[model samples]
Target: MKSKLFDYVERDNLVFHLSGVTKLICFICLTFSVMFSYDIRVILSVMILSLIFFKVSGLEWKQIKLMVIYVIVFLLINFVLTFIFSPQYGVEIYGTKHEIYRFNSRYTITLEQLLYQITKLTKYASVVPLGLIFLLTTNPSELAASMNRIGLNYKAAYALSLTLRYFPDLIRNYQDISLAQQSRGLDLSKKEKLGVRIKNIMNICVPLIFSTLDRIELISNAMDLRGFGKHKKRTWYASKRLKRQDYIAILIAVFVLVGSICISVFINRSRFYNPFI
Candidate 1:
C-alpha cells in the first residue's frame, strides 16, 4: 500500500539523514525565527530556506497538497476574522494610515493593514513547509530518542513518539473507515450538499473512535506485558550520535534565529517593521 499523508519517507538526503535531534532543534529555531519576527524579509528568508529543505527532502507535492489546502483555508478564515474584528490594528501598530478602500466608518482597508495582514499571513505560511519536511522525514522512534537525549523523561518522549506514530495510523484508519462506509451506500461525494457531506462524514467517527480506543487498549496491554516504564532508564534502538552535518545544520538554524532577532532589534528597531516611516 502507498504511504499515507504525513508518513515518514525514507530517503538518503541531507534533511532525512540529519539526526532527529538536529531536525527538532532546527525546526524550533527556524519556526521561532519566523514566528517572532515581523519583518517580511526575515519571514521570506526562512520560508525560502524551508522550501529548499522541502525540495531536498524529496517530498512530493501530492503528499502535502491536502494539508496545504487545509492550512490555506484556515489562514484565510483567520485573516478575515482578524480584519473584521480589528480593522485599524495595523494603523495602530505603524502609527500611520494610508487608506486603500473604505467599506464603512469602522471597516476600512489601509495600506498599513494590508501590509500587516500580508506579513502575518506570510509569517504563518512560512512555517508549513518546514513543519511538513520535519514530519515527513523524521522517524518517530528517532524523534523520541532525541527528545530523551535532551533531558525529557523517557516515558513522555515515548508517549510523544506514540502520538506522532498514531496520527498517520489514525488518518489511515479514518480513510479505511470512510471508504468502507462509502462502499456501504453512504453518499460523501460532491453531489451531496456540503451539509449532507459533512453529516455523512461524521458518521464514520463513531467507528473510528471505537477502533482507536481498542488500539489504545492493545498498546497499553502490550506495554504492560513488556514492563515498559519499570526501569529508570531505557536504551533506544534509534539513538544516534550527532554528526558534523547535524551540528552544522543546528548552527545554521541558530544563526538564522539570532540574525533575525538582531535585525529586528538593531535594524528594524522594533518587532514591527514600520515601512510607512
Candidate 2:
C-alpha cells in the first residue's frame, strides 16, 4: 500500500524553478510584513498577495482544504475567546473604547476590543499563507541544500531534512495502527466523551511510540552498516550549487529588510495615523 504520511508534496510547477533560497527569502519577507504591522490594511494586503502566490505555486485546492479549515477554526476560536475574556483589549491599541455592551462596572464589550481582535486575526491570516507556501513549495532535499549553503553543518542540515521527510511517514504509521486497532475491535470513531477519546488516543500512543523506536533503531543500524557520517564531510547527491538565482534571492532579501526598516522609521517619526485621531 502507498504510504500517505511520507507522501512528498511533489509538483512539476513553476515554483520548483525558483531556487530554495528564493522561496526562503519570500517567506521571510511575508513573515516580517505580517509581524511588523498592526495595521489591518497591511495585513490583509499581504494575505491577498500570498493567496495569489499560492495560486501561482499550483498547489491543489483539495490538498490545501484541510489547512484552510484548520486556519478558520483557529481564527474563530481565538477571536471568540479573546472577546469573551478580554473585551477591553482595544485599550492598548486605540487608547479609548466605544462601549458596545455593559454588563457591569468590570464587564463590558467595546468597539476598540472588537477591532483589536479583528486586527490580531488579520495578522495571523497574513502569516498563515506564507507558512503554507514554505511547506508546500520546498522539497526536503532542496531545503537541506539551502541550509548548507547558509553555512549550517551537513549533519544538522540533513537531520532537519530527515525530520521533514519522516513526518509523513509518522502520520501514515499512526493512521495504519489506528485502522488495525479498529479492525481488531477498538471503537475509536465512537462519539465518546472527550476524556474517553483522550484515553483511547493515549492507548494508541504507547504502541506507536514503541513502533517508532524500533523503526529508528532499524534505520540507525542500516546507516551504520553503510558507513553513514563516517567521513568528515559527506557528499550530497541532491545538493545544488548556488547560482544566479541564489544571488538574486539574497539581493531580494536585503531589499525587503532595508525597505521595512525605512517604512518603520517613517511611520514612527511622522505618526501618519495621528491625524485621524
Candidate 3:
C-alpha cells in the first residue's frame, strides 16, 4: 500500500518490531521529560536522539518535510512573539542581562533572552520526531490494542484507532473532490491570485464535510449492526505480548525521564539552567 502522511510502514527494524505499548510508553516519557525541563543540554540531547531514531526507522525526509516546514514557521513566529512580549523574561529568570543590541530600553535583545528562546525552540523541536515516530511506526489497530492493554476503555480505544486511520481517507477524499472541482473549472492553481485560490479551496470544504458526515453515518450504522461496543471487553487481532526489546526500550525511557527530573531538581536546582550565574 502507498504510504500516506503519517502512515505506518512495516519494516524489520527494532523500532518497528517493538510492541505499540512500548512505543506509547517511551513517547510519553520522553515528551514529558522535554516539556518539564528548560535545560538546553537535556532538550538538545533528546532532539538528537530522536533524530537518530527517526533515521533508523527508515523514514524518508520527504514524508515529513511539509510538517517540519510548518513547525519551523510556527516556532519562528513564537520566537518573535516571545521577544516582543517579554524581552526581559530571561533576565527575570536568570537575574542578569548582557545586552546584545538595543532597539530601545524596552525592546533590547540580550544573550540570556536569545539562549532562552533557543532552548524553548529545541524543547518543542524534540517532540516532533518522537510524535512522528509513534504515529508512523505503530499500526492504528495495534495502538488501540496497546491503549486498551493499558486500561483505557475499549470503546474509546477503538474510536481513537478509527480516528487515526481516517486521516489517509480524508486526504484521498480531498484529492478526489478537489480534482472534481478543478475539472469543473474551479481553478486552485497558480493561475489564480492567492485570495482567489483560497476562496476556491473553501468551496471544496462543503462537499468534503458532507462526504465525511456520510462516512461517519455509514460506519455508525455498520457498528450498530455488528453490535460493536456492546461488550465490556474485546480482543485485538494486532495485539502482541511484549518482548525483551520492549522491556529494554521502556527501561531506557524511564532512565531518561528520571535523569531529566534529577538534573532539573537536584543539579540545576531549577528547571531553567542559568549560565549567567
Candidate 4:
C-alpha cells in the first residue's frame, strides 16, 4: 500500500521531463504573488492560471478530489467566520456602508463587509491551487533532492523526505488496523454514533502510536548502525545532475521573480498593499 501511494506521486513517465526545483520555484513565485496583493481580479487570474498549469502537468482529477473538497471547506469556513465577525469590513476597504441587518450594539450586516469577505476568499482561493500543485507534483525524494541542491544538509533533507515518504504508509497502517479491529468485533463505522466512534478511534490510537514508536526506534537503530550522521557529506540516491532544462527552468524562475517585483511596484508602488484598494 505504501509503495502504491509513492508510485502514484513518483510516476516515472511524468517526472522524467520536469525538474523538482522548477516546480518548487514556480510554486513559491505563484504563492508569493498571491500573497502580495488583495485585488480580487489578480487573485482570480492567478487561480485560473494555476488550474491550467495543473491540467498541463497531467494530474488526474480523481487524485485531487480530496484537495478540491478541502479548498471548498476552507473557503466556506473563512467566509462564514469573516461575515459573522466583521459584517462591516467593507467600510474599511471601500469607505461605504450598505447595511443589511443591525444588531444590538456592535454588530451589523453590510454589503461592503460581504464583498470584502468575498475578496478575501478570492485571495485564499488563488494560493490554494498553487499549494495543491506543489503537493501533488512533488515526490518526497525529489523534494529532498531539491532541498539538498539549495544547500541544506543531506541528512536533514533525507529526514524530511522520509517523513513525507512514510505519511501514506502511516495512514494505510491506521486504516488496516481499524479494519482488523472491526473484523474482531469493534464497530468503528460512523453509524456507531459520534461519541462511540470517537471512543473507538481513541482505542485504535493507542496501538497505532505504539506501532509508530516501534517503527521509529527500529529506524533509529538501523541508522545508528549504518553511521548515518558520522560523516559530513552523505550521498543522495535521488539527486539529478543539473541539465539544460534545469538551467532554463532557473532562468525562467528568476525572470518571474523579477517581473513580479516590478509589476508589484507598478501596481502598488510597494510590496505590502494593493494600491487599487
Candidate 5:
C-alpha cells in the first residue's frame, strides 16, 4: 500500500487489524506497569516482550530508525546526567551502598547505583517500544474513531486525528521546501560549515512554517464546509468493535499491570528491589 502522511499508521500486518481502542487501552496498562515497578527482572521481561511484539507486527526497522535513534540519544543523555549530578541517588533509594570506586569527597560509584540506572533505562526501553508499536501498527482514522467510541468529544477526537496526520505531513513539506530552497541556491549540504548549514535550515524552516499554516487553514475551511462537529456524536465508517484477540490482549496487559503492582507492594515491599539488603 502507498504510504500516507500518517505513514506510521498506514502499515499492513496482523496487528493492523486489531481495534485501535484496544491497543490504546492495552498500551496504557503495560506502560503503567513498567513505570510503576522498579524491578529489574520485570522491566527486562517487559522490554523483551515489547520487542517481540514489534517483530510480530512486521514493521521494518528502517521505517522507525530515526525515531529510535532520537529516543536512544535522549536516554543516553539522561544516563550521563544522572551520574554527574546524583551519583548517590541509587544508594540513597536502595538504602545500601557497595562502593566500587571512590573518586573524591563527593563522588563515588556503587553497585546499587549501577542496578538502579539499569532499571531506569529498562523502564524507558520497555515503554518506548510499546508506544512505537501502538503508533506504527494502528490506523489513525480508526484511532480517532476509537477515541469517539470511548466517550471523548468528537471535536477532541477530530483534533487528535488531525495532529497525528499533521506531523508526517510537516516532515514531507519540510523536505519539499528544503529542495526548493536548494534550487534557489541555498546550500544545506553537510559539505557546508555547521553554522552555514544551520542558516540554510532556518531559511527552509521559514517558508515551511508558512506552508504548514496555509494547509491548516485549508483543512479547517474544508471541515467547516462539511459541517464538522455539528452533532454531539458522529459515526465512524472505519471503526471496528473489539474482537476476541483484542480482548485477550487487553486482559494480558491488565494482568501484567496488576501483577507488577502486587509484587511491588507485597513481595518487594517497595517499588525498588534492594538486592544489596
Candidate 6:
C-alpha cells in the first residue's frame, strides 16, 4: 500500500494537537524574535528552546540533517562574502575592533567581525527548527484552512496547500525516474567522478520537468472538472477549532515577541547586544 502524504503528522506529539493557525502564528512570532534581536543570550535561548520543542514534537535530527547542512553551507558562504565585500562591517556596528589576524591592510580579521558573523549564523540557526516543525508537522489541508480562517483568500490558501502536497509527489517521481535511468546503465554513483555524476543528474531534469508538467495539467483538469472555484467559500474537512492549549501556545509566542522587543528597547538600547561593553 502507498503511504499517505501527511502520515507523518498522525503521530502523537506535544505540538501536533495545536490548531494550524496557532502554529503558524507561533512560528511567525518566533522567527521575528530571532530576526530583530542580536543579544547572544536571546539568540541562544531561542535556539535551545526551539531544539527542545523539536524533540517534543517527535521530530528527529536525522530526518532534517541534509536540509540543515545545506542551510549551514549557505550561511557560511554568505559570511565569507560579507567579509570579502565589507570586512569592517562588524567594527562599524559594534564601535570596537580587536584585531585577530592581519592578512593584509584591508583584509585583517577582527573579533568584532567574527562575532558579528556568529550572531548572523545564530539567528539563522534559531529559526530553522521552527521552520522544519511548521513544515513537517502541519497537515497541508489544515494549513490551508488555517490560512483561510485567518483572512487569506481561499484561492491563495488552497494554492499554497496544493504546492506543499505536490512536493512529495515530485520527490517520488524523481526517485522513480532515477531508478529507471540507472537501470538503463546511466551511473549516478560515487564510483564515477563528481563532475560526471553532476552531468548525469542534469540529464534527469528533462524527464522530471515534463512529468511534473503532465501531473500539474492532470490536477488542474481534475480541479476544473470538479468546479473547484465555483464557490466563494469552502470548508475544510481537516480543519479544527482552537483549544485551550492552542491559545496557550499563541500566548507563549506573543511573549517571545514582546520579550524580544523589550530586550532591544530597554536592555540593549539598540537592536544589537554589545558584548564589547
Instruction: Candidate 6: list runs displaced more than 4 Å.
Output: 1-7, 193-195
Q: Highest TM-score: which candidate?
A: 3
What's the lDDT for all of these models? Answer: 0.91, 0.72, 0.91, 0.71, 0.85, 0.87
Off by over 4 Å in 2: 1-6, 191-197, 241-257, 268-276
Alpha-carbon shift of residue 60 in model 2 (angstroms): 2.7
When 5 and 6 are scored with TM-score, the better candidate is 5
Could you give candidate 3's per-residue lDDT for residues 1-277 as a string of tens digits? Answer: 2336766669889889989999999999999999999999999988998998898899877667768889999999999999989999988989999999999889989999999999998998899999999988999999999999999998999999999899878877888988889899999889889999999999999899999999999999999999998889998999989999999999999999999999999999999999998
Residue pairs clashing, model 5: none
Tens-digit lDDT track of model 4 for 5-30: 33245444433456767777777777
lDDT of 2 at 254: 59
Per-residue accuracy of model 5 over 1-277 as CA lDDT, tens digit each: 2224336735466577789998999889899999999998888878887888888888776667778889999999999899999899998898888999999967898998899988998899889889888887877788899888888887888798888878787877888887778898999778899999998899988888888889989999999999997887888987998889899888988998998999899999999888987
lDDT of 6 by residue, 204-224 (tens): 988999999998899999999
Cand. 4 Cα-lDDT? 0.71
Q: Rank the candidates by TM-score, best first.
A: 3, 5, 1, 6, 4, 2
TM-score-superior candidate, 1 or 2: 1
Among residues 3 or more apart in sequence or in different chains, the pairs in candidate 3 whose N, CA or C atoms overlap within 3 Å are: none
Reference-based TM-score, model 6: 0.93
* Cα RMSD (angstroms) for every candidate in the order listed: 1.7, 3.2, 1.5, 3.3, 2.0, 2.4
TM-score of each: 0.94, 0.83, 0.97, 0.83, 0.95, 0.93
* Candidate 1 RMSD to the correct structure: 1.7
lDDT of candidate model 1 versus the reference = 0.91
State, as a TM-score between 0 and 1, how close model 4 is to the true structure: 0.83
- Cα error, candidate 4, residue 175 (Å): 1.2
State model 3's lDDT.
0.91
